[model samples]
Target: MAKLILDTFREGYGVDQIRKTMTVGELIGFLSDFDEDTPVYLGFDNRYTYGGITEGRFEMDYGEEDDE
Candidate 1:
């Protein structure tokens, strides 16, 4: 199965100060119901462009404060 990730914050600019985020554990919780073999694709730039998971791995960019 294939999964798509929507970009919820598409219109924002200079959002470096915004601290709203989800933790890895929280994200995992959200996906707890999904099958382990499901493939995930990131909806990036727009709904048309997608970033795919390679070898069951993907990278997430986060700010310093998100370490807490």
Candidate 2:
């Protein structure tokens, strides 16, 4: 698996400052710099999980909140 790093958080990226969506073209542009053989994984709760893209079923999740 390819290791992806997000060092921007240390530069002051927060929930409110992060983008919530990306178009396919935008995604391609963002990933154009990376190697083609890299595996894609989704990050959540500081953990990375392999998205079922190859299985033809991709799931999108926004995570959960305490709502307290």
Candidate 3:
């Protein structure tokens, strides 16, 4: 099983926004507030490995140490 974190955002006059830390099947259940066929944009912060696919998904680290 994978751990997932869901976050949502609504703009002034834009489509409903949803973000997740990792892809999960149950993630769709959280979108009940929105339309059933609404278009969604999914994104994540991860490293691209092999054939340009994201792997070892991890949050970006930024700081003096990261700048080195």
TM-score (all chains, Cα) for each model = 0.56, 0.46, 0.23
Query: In candidate 2, what are the lDDT values of residues 1-68, reduced to their tens digit?
Result: 67654322222365455556578899889889889877665445455433323655756756567522
Ranking by TM-score: 1, 2, 3
Q: Please write out the lDDT profile of model 3 over residues 1-68, one tens digit for every residue.
A: 33233233333452223333434555556766566555443323432212222347545556465444
- True-structure RMSD, every candidate: 4.4, 8.4, 13.6
Q: Candidate 3 overall Cα lDDT vs. reference? A: 0.41
Question: Residue 6 in model 1: shift from native, Å?
Answer: 3.7
Index of the highest-lDDT prediction = 1
Model 2 misplacement above 4 A: 5-19, 48-52, 58-68
Q: Using TM-score as the measure, name the better of candidate 2 and candidate 3.
A: 2
Candidate 3 Cα outliers beyond 4 Å, as residue runs? 1-26, 44-68
